[model samples]
Target chain A: MSEELAAVEETARRRGSRPIVWLAWFLLAFFFVNLAGIVFSAVVDSFGDNWFGNWLPQVWTTHYWSDAWHAYDLGQVLQVTLIVSVAVVIVSVLVGVPASYALARRNFPFKHAIMLVFLLPVMVPPIAYGIPLATAMYKFNTITHVQIANSMFGVILANLVPAIPFVVLTMTPFIEQIDPKVESAARMCGASTRKIFTRILLPLLVPGVLAASILVLVRTVGMFELTYLTAGTDSETLVVKLFDSISGAGIRAPQQSDAMAVLYMGMMLVLLVIALRFVNPTQLVTRVAEERDA
Target chain B: MTVAPPAPAPARRHRPPDPRAHLSHRLAERGIDRTLWLLLPGVVFLVALFIYPLAYGLGLSFQPLKSTDPLYNYKQFFTDHLQRDTIGTTLRISLPAALVNVIASVPIAYRMRGRMRGKRFITTMLVIPITLGTVLTADGMLKFFDPAGGWFNKTLFALHIRTPDQPVLLINNYWGVVISLIISGFPFAFLLILSYLSGIDPSLDAAASTLGASPRRRFWQITFPLLAPGLAITFCLTFVLAFSVFPSAYLVGNPTSTTRVISIAAYEARSVETNDSKASTIALIMAVIELLVISVVLFGRGRLYRGSTGGKG
Candidate 1:
């Protein structure tokens, strides 16, 4: 009697757990299908000559790709994008690396408060400050005639607002993990400060610097709101231009817009792939949060 | 080598009373800290670009349009229907989308909790939408969810769920916006929850099972309680992301009023209406709402995880 009851209980437990296991697999499958479907649909539509009420496009061509390229003036857009991204990366690293070193090594007054100040730009959405930043830029340009607003300089400056802080936060951990005694030892060997920084510290810090710069590059490319608000007709990045192509009150074909999207996606995918090689996405979130809390 | 060093020191001591030495001595006397100087460049940059602008925006929001009523913009934000609906519209979409994403991710994450094959692959796939961003996702949604000849309607027609004439209205509506938000928001929420779940020890469940507890009871009694704080935090972060919806709302939904979130309202007030003060008012209100929600979630999390060891066992 006892054996029979145990068997029956075992069977019931299996029955109860079977659906959950099936559900997990189903959810996984659903996630793949949904993500793949969205991405593939865009790619296919971009090349499709005509796709109406069909599982596949009736015809495919590369015509829209060229059309989007010239019609959107993508050459200029891409040039501006590269220029802005590179400038933001270089300036942020120059400004952030030393600050990160200081933050890692020093005990200072109002350190937590200062850290929170850096955190604000990142934690808060860009739109919160973007309006006023744009306004100030416009005001500055009108007053000084320096033309920072609606220019490439303005866009780079705007991108740097978040980029610098991100670099500081990410590089602080990298700097912290290194032993400070190494630097002191280099100094004790009668090396000048510049030699210590250039010869010893730079080599050890290369991996972290590379990771931070790659992330900054990715962010500058993907940043939308600030660029959208600040970019002029001549200075729009890929993302801002893509937004214009979609809603710019022009009578462009949807396929052409899809093509532009595909281009944007291509650029982002390459950068993201590179970034993932250096940093885990899970660790990325935790690092950002941990810095804010600390 | 040591004799050469001593000869260099003699030359420096006799080098016409070095001006740089006096300057260095003065600087040292004034307590010119190197670390402070090192931090100055970044500090100046952030203050000039970030802090000044945020403060200016707040100050601008309080300025009166007529120079008579100091509270003009604030009053307008509350009294004006169009401005006021933005708050309601933003909340209506953001709250439900965030809640749905959090709730839906729980069961899926719970099921995938233990060591499983392809977990990394699954996570990578999930992160694709986030990388794609809102612009790409909305663009794809426009094509996929088209009513007349889109894949979605075609599938529905073939499935006999709806006739050709009665195609479902998926895009340019409230549900369409909500669905798009979910598509983008779910991946992030799922990643957070999965990471949280991984931090939980598996032995608790094993112990519970050995004690004759069923799987369902083990989950509810042991796992769910421990997961509450993580759930609260995940929901708060995702909620902030959803609340700031701008591109998707504009691209896929009825942005005039139904899906006109506060970001849109601020954009219009500043760009279309060219009213910086009103835009600042809207932006500040949005920030306040986000902060309030986050604080509430944190407080609740403190209560939930107050003495619990988070199952480090």
Candidate 2:
């Protein structure tokens, strides 16, 4: 009798969870289907001759892709993107890693205040600060004749505002996870500070640095507001190019715009794939959330 | 090759020790060592690029080009109907979208919190939007959700949800921005809430179940209270992101009027009108509004939960 009752309870529990499990799956399916459809449509529309009011384009061609490439000067745009992304990655890591080591391994007066200053750029959206930054850059250009605004140099600097803080935030937790005894052991071996950092810490920090780099690379590519505010004609990245193509009143087919967008999306997807290989997406959010809780 | 030191060095000791080395020793005692110098470059960069610009902009806002009044820019923003109504328009779009994103993610995240098959696959799929960003999403959304010939309408028509004569007009209107926000913001809220949910002890839920509490009861009575603080933070962050809706409002929605968020106002003021003072004023206003909303949520969160829900985690 007891066995039958327990069996009945088991069935009841399963039945209770059945609808929720189904609902979860249904939502996931719904979201992915829409996402896939959205992305796929861009690809299909770019190649379509004149797709209108149909499930599939009646005709397709690669002409738009070529047209967009030349019309948008995408070759230069892509090169600028690569340059900006790579520069931001290297510079941010170089500047941020040592700061992260100091922040993680020591206690100092106003540490939290310093951290809040670093955190502000990441927490606040770019548009809030980008306006001021761009305005200041322009003013500086007029006064100092340095020409930072509306130039490639300006774009790199604007991108770095958030990127450096992000690197520090991500790397701090990674440094904390390493045992301090490792550093002590190096010290015991009579290794100087610089030598310990170069010989001991750098080798152990490769995975963390790689993860931070890829994440920053992906962000800098997609960064729009700051770059848009600061970039000049010659300095525009692929994303800025795509935006101009869309909002521009140029007499080009919509398919051309779609083609440019596809190229941008393709680049982003590749970078994302590489980033995911080295980092667990959840691990990134966990640290930030834990910090908030503390 | 050892050399003996000079006898006692008493005469040299009359002068103060090297001032630089003495200062360094004091600084190091306070946890500022050579390693701390590494923080200098980043701090200098931020101050130069972020803080100084913002300060300059703030000062500039007070000195509008045409008006002598220090408050003229602020006055103009509040007085002009076109500019003033944007506060309402922005909130109308951001609030519902953020609320829906946070509220919807709670249940889904709750169910998916435990170890499960294909977890990484689903998490990665959700996180893809963060990297895809507003630009790509907006571009794709314009094509995918186009009323005239988009797949969404096609699907609706095929499913008999609506007649072919009447397709859903999602794009180029208010609903378009909301949908775009949900698409991008939902994943972020999900990721944040999932982390918070996973931090809770599972034993509490098991104990509740053992006590014969129904699943629904256990969630509402136990988990919901514990999860409130996290939900507040997730909502606040998501709300902030949603409030700064610029690219989507431009690309997917009607940016001229229906989806004219404050960011658009600031953008037009700076880029179109070339009025740096006016633009700075609007940007400051946007930041103030965001801070107000955030502080209110956080204050309520403080009242809602005073202490941590104890757990091994």
Candidate 3:
């Protein structure tokens, strides 16, 4: 009876471990197919008149590489996207840092109420915010010098809603982490108010601020929703070019568009990895995941 | 407890005066001036960017496009060209996708708990969609999931010798959108759960295991109960994310009036028809509904984690 029981327990342990095996398989399946598709796209585009066909043919060339450059509006799209991203980062930090600290520190009345005010940008999706932001900008003729629609500025303005939240969220933890005792020490030394901030607090906040800025850059530059709505016909971003090309030709040259897509992906991935060095990426994803597991 | 003992005074100094001494002592005790100075930039930034935007947005909502007393953009949105259908569509797509994402995320998250083989690789793969930009993923799906030249139909035909002309799975339809949602939405939920999983007290789990409970029973009794709050948060986040589903749908979802959600409707109102007031009203309406939903869920999640060792006692 003891021997039989030992065997049964061993069998149960094996059964318990099966889910991990299955998950490994499931992830592999998803990744492999996409990998294959990319390779097939590369090889087939080289060989045949059927531009986006399933298989390779006898005749092949590097036509798509050149085509990818011009088929999509690669040159202009990247410029607009980079410009919008930089602007959003500047504005978000300008807006979010002070707001986040006030919420994190301070004991004024309506304190919680003040924090609640910032949550609107976070709760509502860009789709919802984009309409009013874009429309309001349009009313003033300030969208872009390049005919407003499809311009870089529109995307930057619309992106502010989400980017501001990113700043507030990231800055809250860092600001709240400051040791209050240090500030008290400065006071006892007879330091003037301006002297204390300029000399003390600002220096300490450098790492925190750098972390916040990189975070804002990575997401804001890559943002898509508001850009799609507000950008002019001629001012395609990297995403717009990618979307137009693979889905079939728009003004973006199709063959060259693939190269732009690959380049965009490469740039974004590099930035994300760099950002990860500054801040924890898991903080964004696992806020809820951690809750479920705990 | 940690404060320094009072400093030694100058040797020749006389005893301090009463009122001046009293007033100086109080200011020194509270350190209010020093604290405010440290907090200035953050305070100024919040007031200008966050508070201003929200107040302005609210004001914009009430303002009318035309003349005088609270004009009728709200009225215009109600009457506009098939514009009213947007809310219904956005919620229909958003709600289902969010729910699906939250549910699918659990299994992957469970597998990821405590670090097993290939875990980092799996996590990276899951987050690829997020980094790749929503547009690229949707575009990739468009290239691969189409009926004729796409991967799904092509694969099925190769394996089973089925009809090649049959519709491809997950392209322009609601499922396509859900696939995108699951791909992008799952990583954050999975990571959040994974962190929470790591934080859970192993002793409680050990106690449950010793009590003759099976693994599944232990999870339900010990893990799931504690995890309820986290689940609620994940649901709200995933819902908000899917709620704003535009680029993926617009880029990949074949632009039928059927898939065009409220964002598209609001966009058309302002851009296509040139009506800022109505668009503002519509956007405000969206903000109100989403905010209301988020508050109800967040408040109901029981409590924020209170025992964490991050703060001063």
Q: Per-residue lDDT for B218-272 in model 2, tens only?
A: 8899889999999998999899889989888998888999999999999999989
Enumerate clash totals for all models, in the order shown.
Answer: 0, 0, 30
User: Tens digit of lDDT per residue, candidate 1, span B1-313?
Assistant: 3554443444454335446676765554444457667788888999999999878888888885656677888888899898888888988998999999998888888877765687767776676777777888888877777888777778889999988899998778888788888888888898888778776766666667667888788778988888888899889878877887888889888999688888999999999989888887788787788778888888888888545434431
Q: Which residue ranges in model 1 land beyond 4 Å of their true spot? A: A1-18, A179-196, A288-294, B1-33, B203-214, B306-313
Instruction: DockQ each candidate and list the results.
Output: 0.33, 0.49, 0.32
In order of appearance, the predictions have TM-scores of 0.86, 0.91, 0.78
Backbone clash total, candidate 2: 0
Candidate 1 residue pairs that clash: none
CAPRI docking class of candidate 3: acceptable
What is the per-residue lDDT of model 1 for residues A68-158, given as tens digits with 9 covering 90 to 100? 9989999999999999999999999999999898888876667788798787787676887788889889889989999888999999999
lDDT by residue (tens digit), candidate 3, B94-176: 78777766666666665566546777666665565667766666656666676776656677788876677665567787777
- The weakest ten consecutive residues by lDDT in model 2 chain A span A285-294
DockQ of 1: 0.33
| Winner on TM-score (2 vs 3) | 2
Candidate 3 Cα deviation (angstroms), residue B270: 2.1
Question: What's the ranking of the predictions by lDDT, best on top?
Answer: 2, 1, 3
The best candidate by lDDT is 2
